[model samples]
Target chain A: MHDMMIPFGPAHPALPEPVHLKLFLEGEEVKDVDFSVGYNHKGIERTLEEMDFSKSIFMTGRICGICSSAHSTCFTQGIEKLLDVEIPQKAKIIRTIVFELERLTSHLLWLGMLGHEIGFDTLFMLCFREREYVLDSLELITGKRIVHDINIIGGVRRDIPPEMIKKVNKNLGILKDKVDYLQTLIKKDPLIKKRTVGIGNIDKDDVEKLCLVGPVARASGVPYDIRRTDKYLIYDDLNFKIVTQKDGDSFARAIVRVQEMFESIRLTRQALTLIKPGLIRNKPAMTFTEKEAISRVEAPRGELIYYIRSNTTNKPARVKIRTPTYANLMCLNKVLVGNNLADVPVSLASLDPCLCCTDRVTVVREGKEEIIKLEDLHGHH
Target chain B: MFHAIVDCVGDGLIVDKIKKYCLKKSPWIFHFCTGGCNGCDIEILAAMSPKYDFERFGCLVKGSPRHADIFLITGPVNKKIKSRLVNLYNQIPEPKVVIAMGSCALSTGIFQKAYNVCGPLDKIIPVDVYIPGCPPKPEAIIDGIVKGIEVLAKKVK
Candidate 1:
């Protein structure tokens, strides 16, 4: 039997994002899969090198639009560590609120996309419509919908007024009801289960071997959420159980994300109740010492780690970001093989691969183009 | 300029008028993210929601460039995707409008100093509309698409 190779994206109907995957099939039975992604690279890591420590926080926030707070918080935590300054309790709670809200929005968006992927437009509309509540709440609290540049080095940028808290609570109440409905649909819907169950199966050993993070890992029964392991920010005080599922398939991934939203909502409510007015940020000295600091945050997708090396000057010496999606790419490949061609798109989307964050590290210097033999590059992916 | 180009290219006035009319009504858009973060992309998706449904205005987010009338491009145009960007642009038919959807597309936004990105999208392709934000809000994105339809209507047949 002859083998046929099928290509899926750089830009395809099922994928809203950009990623290229090459699947080798032997008459509809997949033998192997290869994927390469440099399409979304913007080289933000190199740009961070030239910016001041505080200014870079905003830059980091843009590293992934969905997880902006995670990046900024991770970067600021690193800088705050280097500066040896402790932010007030209010800042920690504020950061937690935004962080969890970002997760809520992200998970909702993912659910909508998952629905859209498998030809269920109704679910897509429902999820996106419900997502507006979270966005509105975020706008009320941080004054921005998508990229809330609230996390600065010493502390957060804004505090939720009593009135704003009430408004956010009201919004969350509405959202919680809608999400509960969606969760029920997700859990009990036979169509969703039929489509996602047993698709993109990755065993526990495969997950561990690939070093996957976030929902993808938890879905595989790995039980390793950075929020619990690293215990940064206010997570040590926050009360929530780490969500995990044992199936290690596409269905398990969706289940993990959906249940985790409830945990995130609970955490947000707790933070809002505990949040008392004091101070948002402490003015740390602009001058930084020569040292390296690394910070990790559980971004909506997975474990987002930031590495920062700073000099005595205001500018950072070097910066490197290890986004969670980048780590999960390997597992994405493993899950795609042996699936029907029709199921390829749904299986791929189930991983929730954020290509935009995965491939932003290009190190070629200005005016120094490194030319590679075109034929030689064919061996890599 | 659109009329003059149509005059030169010579799609008859009656047909050209019909083309312009239909283009303004249902501006089927195809969104592409060249590089940078996905913030602007999410905003684009949000604009499609019920709160700000661009669909009622004939704005459909098409997946393929072949059926698209307007190109909603997010992120900075990095060097790796440069050729692909041009390829997609070439795929769209005539009288198409290109809308640069974020701060990154307008002028490289946050990644202005990145070594990889060649530059803003305009340097690679002709950009008609620019929505300026680290990620412009859904309202702004909707406004930009409306502007794109206007620009598309004005373009030569």
Candidate 2:
């Protein structure tokens, strides 16, 4: 029995933000694991409480940079739902296109990071080298790459340009070939195979109980994708298969993201063909109708949920965001247990946890006095 | 008289070597998210990725008291996150440069005039290099990093 349990981090090189892991170890194998988060909490939820309707849009986007588009989209969709306004079909299609672009960028980043974690430095470079094309294409089309601010409450902000369509088609071809080549490499590469296979195994039945989503749940063979199961935007019109694998391991998660990249291209091309000329913005309500609504989107990580309440004012009464990484983090305890300490980074990264998206909540035990931040974790570092 | 100056400078070898060393050493950067959005954070992750190679030049996004020779920030620094902006700027380690990569980090273009947004990265975070476009191209980011090094060299003794 080890006398002292070492706390890995609330701040460490392994993670961008602070996530504390209490490792109970007998040699290399972890006997028991305790994890706590909230170091990066910004009191977004509480802050949203004081903000108005339109203001909530920008606030929600801050939940996580990678999925900010999905966040804003979900928030705006929720507002539209509360108002019971039917969005234009053209707008819907554009929303789908932009959403998929965000997914592609996010997944590509995850792939590169996963490669780096296992010491495959060259693969990481290759992935980012290819990723620059997507960034350029997104910049050309949306006028910016990251927070497109494309989806508005009633519609999108801009129309897809003709030159942009050509760029998309060209890049789509390149991405397809790249994804195909990398898929083969990832499958047969001994280094990747050795590092990822069977590293993070979650029980099949535990998924429903744990409430996992996106690639993590799908990789476990749950076949639960928000777009397929709960269609949003133009997902109903676009035809793309949900990528999944039964192995429920880190490799499975990696493969799921790889396949999704191809699907994103197919969806984007179809969207481009389907997009028609129409008004990009509908007249936004001058005042809210004072109603509550829920909006969900298939973020690159998983189903992103946003709940907003408008109090007949420009400011929202409340805004709640359930980021995909938050839900996925719940299952980390199950995944991390009984695995070698070396596998910790892969398992955690496999969930693709977005620390920025999660609300800060931490329970610290020091000399039997537990400290809870309540909703005020924002002020603390 | 002119010939003596050229000879002392070693036929621009000093400049070329300095460019090479600084390009590989001090890549100062500023992070800007034009419209208080966070997507730039993820995109910047591409550079930080083992593949994109942000660290090859010893570049890092410093937090506070601006110890960073480069300002590598994310988001447009929303009204809520704006208060932290002063802290972020003050913490940057001296002789710094800033790079605003994303569109939101530039002008808050799409999200302009929305309630509760300070809007535009230049409002805060004194920017040096502006990589325009929604999320600026990664090559653009690298280019900005290189340019930042050049700018830093010119300012120094």
Candidate 3:
């Protein structure tokens, strides 16, 4: 029997971005995989060196749209810390609200993608249909749905208006019930379980070693939620359980996210009632000698960390971002092995991988290794 | 405004009716990411959500250039994606319309100075419409697509 090497991309239909994987196949089972990335190397980190500290705040949000608000908040928080400025309590509550909303939308979007990946178009449409409510709520509050642009240095840009609070309450109630219905449909739906259960199979040991965060890590029974480990904003004031599963498979990952949606609903409700009025943002220090701070926020995918260094100028000396997807991409090689070709898409979908937002896997293989890109495979077959 | 509209309308009820019908139905879209910032991608998604409801107008995002009638290009087209974009544009059948969304795609926005970036989508692709925003509002995206449908119908002549 002849062996073949297939590469999955920096661009693949199964994946939204360009993450390339080179798989060595022995009779259609993955024997080994080499990861390749860098197709989307826009020099984001390098570009930061030239930007001023003030401008860098907004610039960082462009890192990934799905988590733009998180990036903006995290970047500003890092700078604020460097300036030794404690954000107004109102800003904290607003950040929490925005953060949870981001989580809600991110998880729902991932679920829709998961459904679409497995060829379940109906479920995709349904999940997205509910996601619209969240978007509307976001737009009504922040004026923009995807990139809220609400977070700023010292605090948030806008405060929750009185009328908006009622709308938020009503929307949350509707979202809670609709999300519950969707979760039930997802859990009981035999087709989803059939396609997702035991698909990727990232064992507990591998999960820890990979250091993957968010629902992917929680699904593998790692109770290392950054929101818990590194308390930020008003997470300490809120009460919500960390959703997890011991199965360590795509289905488990999916379930964990679905359950977490409920927790987000709970958190959003708590935030609405608990949040009190105060200054949304603080005036930034006019000048800084030389200071650096690192801020980490729990994004929907996982922990989003931003490192900001200011050198007595409006522009930042250095801005570094570590998105959760970067760490998660490291675990892909370990999980892809021994999976059948047919199961590859489902397995890959488990990470809810967004190559655009996640790390690009770069595979290095030796002679007789024919590399196959995910995009090429997706296009061909 | 009426005079300008009448001038643009050109006394063609047949074209007007066809254009209106096309605008109301079958608004095909193409997604281009000039630079690979995925912010615009998510917003495009926001437009598709039940909240924004672009599909009610019969709009669908197609993967292939051939199937797409309207281009909803996101991101700032970088060096690698630049040539591929031209190739994709060539493959798209005639009567195609292009709409550049997001700041990066417009004037390269924040990523303007980056060495790898191919600033402004118009440098390579002929843009028929532009929706300028860091990430344009979802309604703005729908507006761009609707405008694109109108442009495509006009070109059918």
Candidate 4:
């Protein structure tokens, strides 16, 4: 029997996102954890079906604010495949640049949240202060700060002018130094080490079993990045290493993400240099036949896959998204069960669960959990 | 006759004035994200960070609704969180103000046609200020909170 069952959030102080976890504890040690997401679901897949392909691209970008570009990129890549269109080389480089910068911002945001969860306000402050540089560069390129609607169906909607490139490069230069300082601080800080070092340990085998992607898998020594495996979006041309760590703990995850930020900085700079004078969009024909295309991209969190099906019209018949958090969520029990109650927030944040992306279609009927199809959802509505 | 009446009421009135002043200076905030994307929530945090420094206006983001003077709400309210949002609003003590941040909270934004959304926050609760954006910039969020503090001050009186 459990000594206590504490409900953490639909709204909680530790993590502001809407995920509810019922923690069964015995003397401050968490014995079991049952978590439910779907508080943030807006039935996006169903909504996608109602909108045309051109409009749905922006809608997909709003699916998760942190990984907005990743969703749109994946969707666009899938749409391009369905239309049998090839985006220009310049457009591919531009997408890659925006993609990496978005990763930098998302990872920085995650790092700050980790600090806040552990009661280190200074680290949080420092991370956010540094994050503005990345946000500014993104704004310079994409004309928006948070939800960057940079991708269109065939290619990108905007071009990075030469003057903007210089300014963005300058921002990246300053950011590189600040990131170095932060990396040193994380490595040396005893408080952070005490809070995260061995907490929420997931072994490599567990990572494979759970089929986790992104930094979570990399932290467990699994080099299963979609960027390397799929090599979509000019990643084939770019030179970068997949960051991996062997510990498979919270600290290892932090290390993997921090190291990847450096790699992102490098990749973004490389992709920026590769951006030559060329057409940004291929402007494919709007017509479509019966087709289905699955496109994958390594988002800041992990592998984000978009399966889009189109009929004779421009509207996608069915759009399905598989976000990384959905897969990483499987190990929540593994992370929380043996740990102290105080570490719950840190451990959970370490997994970097983006509930906005994860909670799309979940139906509970007669005590059985099922994923209802978009057609069924629409009919019920 | 006027002097005698003034002397009697001045001390209590002075104390009340000081109390109101303090309330206006430091308006503790409680942030809740109903169901929108995390854009606004992160923007709220950014406002609190050193760059925007919302704390300069004596605003602190509190965890519990009971300790809050202004409720900062983001996202379009969804069915799952509707009752919870109302319950949370009721939990805040009297003299509370709600500032709806982001376009979604104002009118459901792009998710207006979404099946699960049941919001535009004001339908569920009274909203004093609306900061409109896909996710309003941190500066705008801070500005909205300052306005919320003003509304809270009026409510206290």
Candidate 5:
């Protein structure tokens, strides 16, 4: 029997985002899988090098629309560490609220896309509709629905206006009820359960071996939520459970995200209540001496870490981002092998891979393409 | 036999005209996010959501370029996907319209000077409509597609 090779994406509806996969198949069963990314590389790190510390926060914010706040927050945190500036308490609370709201929107978008992949159009539309409430809240707070450039070095650009606070809470209340409904639908819907249950199963061992993070790891019962582990922002002060499921399948992944959205909602509420009138930013010195710092945040996908090095000038000497999706790519290929061809979409979606976050640049040197791995990058010498 | 052949040709011309008219009335759009942020892509999806519902004008978001009448492109085209974007554009039949859906698609937006970017869709393909925003709102997207329908009508004529 001749095994045919088929290439998927860079563009395909099944995997909505960009990434190319080469699948070797024996009849309907996938035998081997190889993949390449960088279809979304925007040269963000290189761009950061030329700009001063202040402007690059907006650049990093554009890294991935789904997790824009996370990137900016991570960047700002790293820069603040370099400058040795402490942002005001109110700023930290505002940042936390925005981060969790982004998580809520990102998960809702992922859930809707998953429903679309499973051929459940109703759930897809419903999730997206409910997501509007989150978007509206974000727009009300940050002035933009998608790319909320709320973060600035040493603090945030805007405060939560007093007039909008009541409006924000009202929207969250409606959203909470809708998300609870969604959780019930995901749990009890036979169609969703039949399609997702027992699909893309991987034990905790493989998840660890691949060095996965976020809900993907949590779904496998790894319990590695970065907000708790890193204690960044005001997460340490907040009370929230790290939701995990042991089944390690697509359904388990979905359950983990659904549970996390509820947690994010709770976190957002808590952070909002904690918000008070105070200074939002600390003014830093105009010049930079050589210094470096690393910062991490629990982005919607997983752990997002930013490393920044300050040279003698205001511009950064180097910036490195280790996004969660890059780590999750290992498990995508591992799970694809031995699965029926039809199950491929949901299995891949279960990982919730964001190529825009993962693929920063594809460097071609001497006729060979090379991707810089996470560990290879270091701060300025 | 010659009279019958002439009559058949005349009927075929009328059938072709009807098809062309239908194409203007309902142009299927296929969206390709080459690579900027996912902001424009989500706005496109939001436009298709029940609240905005681009389908009211009989337009549909098609899965295949071959079946589409308009190509809704978002993001600045990354270097790696530029060739793929061209390939997908070629796959769509002519008398088609291309709408550059965001600031990135129009001028590469914030990522304009990046090394990996190869777009501002007009540089690679002939763009009929340009909706300018970091990510254009859903109402604007609907308006852009409506403009695309007008472009399609011109091409058909």
Candidate 6:
């Protein structure tokens, strides 16, 4: 059979985000895959340089809606390190609770999208329906459903009161049961197994070589969670298992995420117990030397790292972000090539590629792709 | 002869009324994200989920622009997507309503000072309804669509 090339959207039904993929097909099999991002680039890194250090935390929170708390927490943690300020214990617990709940919401959203991609709309509905509980809990804590800008430079913005903690715990109790049902449904559903099992298989060596992070790496039998290693926030004080699977396929990734959601529930509940009514924010006096600090947090997708440098002024000298989707994107060819054309969406969705987080800093110039250096990017302004 | 003519005219009027009613009742949506945070896009999806039940209004998010009646746009219009947004706007059939959701769509929101952004969406195409929030809640999105249907009903006439 002659080879044919199919263009899979900068805007396609299978993908809610904008990503263009060129798939070369030999009959029914995908011979090769080429993908291009930057359709969702908003130049956020450069925008960060112009905003105040305090305000930029909120700006970073808006980077990815799914993991807003992750970005802001990482950014704030970096800023705290730069300023040599340690947040209070209460603040630490609050940050951890928000961080983990954000994980639950992000993972649930990913599950729903995975179902939608595989033509299983029922699973999509069920996942989104249960997701409301998490969103409600987030709303109670942070005052917003999607973008919970709860983190500040010194610490968190909102403290979890006793009543709020009780409510959030109630939601987690319900979510735990729903997640259990989802786990069974995912495992027993033959169609889900057929679609996912052995598809998008990534081996342990490839994960290490490519520097994959989050569940994508864990699914390949790598216990490389930054939360466990770095012990950032109150993670070192809490006890939770790093979920992993040996298969390293799409199904393994789903299982890893679903199981991780249970861990998140446990972690949130533990952190809620740890919260004491002392102080939420330290109100650090804004002072800066020519100092740079790096912070890493395990966002729902994976490890999100932020580099923050501060000058004498209130504005940050520079801020750089490395999102998990950017790191996981390295395995796209491994996931897509050789798969059936029909399996492309399901396999790609399994990676949980957040193009919005990945597509920062590249600009198309006069129809030619150009990579802007940090200094040159500043020059543009 | 007069009675027969009256019956024909009455049937034509009734069909027109039904057509207008269906147009107002069930408006198919096409969502396009022009370079902003995924916050608004996800909220749009949440609005369609089981809890919000956006489909009860007979609204469906269509894959192709040709199949769309309401163009729901989110994000700041960046330079790369500016042309494509115009192309998509042109592809949708006439009597369509354009609803720009999110603060970024309204005025470029936080990415206002970014070099890549070319718009608040209105500069590229005329927008009929504006739903503003960093990322508006699902209920607000549904309200905006209901308002857009009103604008669509007027245009259908």
Question: TM-score winner among the candidates?
Answer: 4
lDDT of 4 by residue, A1-381 (tens): 999999999889987788889999999999998877667878889999999999999999999889999999999999999989989999999999999999999999999999999999899999999999999999999989999999997789899999999999999999999999999999999999999999999999998888988999999999999989998989999899999999999999999999999999999999989988989998888999999999999999999989999999878999989999999899999999999999999999999999998887756679766767644653432
lDDT agreement with native, every candidate: 0.85, 0.72, 0.77, 0.90, 0.86, 0.89
TM-score of each: 0.93, 0.77, 0.87, 0.95, 0.93, 0.94
Which runs of model 5 end up more than 4 angstroms from their true locations?
A361-381, B1-13
TM-score of chain A of each: 0.94, 0.92, 0.91, 0.95, 0.94, 0.94
What clash count does candidate 4 reach?
0
Per-residue lDDT tens digits for candidate 6, residues B13-129, read 666676577777788999999877889988988999988988988899989998788999999998777777899999988778999999999999888998778898898899999
Between candidates 3 and 4, the one scoring higher on TM-score is 4
Model 1 per-residue lDDT at A17: 71
Q: DockQ of each candidate's interface versus the true one?
A: 0.62, 0.18, 0.31, 0.58, 0.53, 0.55
**Cα misplacement distance, residue A30 of candidate 3 (Å):** 3.6
Worst 10 residues of 6 chain A by lDDT: A372-381
In model 1, the number of clashes is 0
Q: List the candidate 2 regions with Cα displacement exceeding 4 Å.
A: A1-4, A360-381, B1-40, B48-157
True contacts kept of 6: 0.77
Q: What's the lDDT of the predicted structure labeled candidate 6?
A: 0.89
Q: How many Å off is the CA of A252 in candidate 4?
A: 0.5
DockQ of 1: 0.62
Candidate 4 lDDT over residue span B61-154, tens digit each: 8898888788989898987778889999999877788999999999999998998898889998999999999989988987888888888788
Candidate maximizing DockQ = 1
How much is A245 displaced in model 5, in angstroms? Answer: 0.5
Q: Compared with the real two-chain complex, what DockQ does model 2 have?
A: 0.18
What is the per-residue lDDT of model 3 for residues B1-157, given as tens digits with 9 covering 90 to 100? 1223335767587656655565446756767565456777777876786668798878887655666678777777666555666877897766678888878888888888775676688888899999988778788888888888778767765
Interface RMSD of each: 1.7, 6.4, 3.6, 2.1, 3.0, 2.3
User: Over 4 Å off in model 1, which ranges?
Assistant: A360-381, B1-18
Report how far residue B77 has shifted in candidate 2, in Å: 10
